[model samples]
Target: MQLNPEKDTELSQKVNRETARLPWSELMRHFASGNVVWIADELDLVDVAVRIAHDDKASVGQWMAAGQIAKVSDAQARDWLETDTSLWACVVSPFILVQQQKIRH
Candidate 1:
């Protein structure tokens, strides 16, 4: 899911706004990290966020604001992904399921 450059910039801003300490690049990298991948499986959130960032950064901001993704500090997000596999999967799975449903529909 390739996002337009403009949207990517905006989404990055939005994600940053919600997770103050987690920069967009860092977040993406974190999502892609081996630990996160092993614990949480695929990174659908990062993929979608990347796509959304390319198109509508504001919407990404809205998602972060809506508390769909646990808006924790960078340390906490990292810790959660590291220590809480079930919780991390719970948060990430819904987005992937929703996206799958959208594609199916």
Candidate 2:
């Protein structure tokens, strides 16, 4: 199957539109959610937003509405984790562990 250049471009534009609308605060909230998968996905989202915002603050809702970014799902989160096991150990898994430790004390 051949790629349709117009459709691809349109699709990308739509994605951009959706992503750009996500506001920065909401983005951070998503990052803070208890679900490791949600945090992992939002981490990727924030990485992109930080790059785009450069020095400016952007919102999650803005990015969502702008369609510039695609939200990550649980399956995608698993792929990300599988690709970097250390990431899971150091990031997603440990945060909960650390918080739990603190709570236990």
Judging by TM-score against the true structure, name the best candidate. Answer: 1
Model 1 spans > 4 angstroms off:
1-47, 52-55, 70-105
* Candidate 2 local lDDT, 63-92, one digit each (tens): 445653344445644554455422221122
Give per-residue CA lDDT, model 1, range 1-105, as digits (tens): 344677666754554333222223344444544222221123344444444434456665555566543333457456645753233221232121111111100
lDDT of 1 at 11: 59
Report lDDT (Cα) of residue 100, candidate 2: 8
* Alpha-carbon lDDT, every model: 0.38, 0.34
| Alpha-carbon RMSD, each predicted model | 12.1, 16.4
Q: After superposition, how far is residue 79 of candidate 1 from its true place, in Å?
A: 5.2
lDDT of 2 at 26: 31
Residue 41 miss distance in model 2 (angstroms): 18
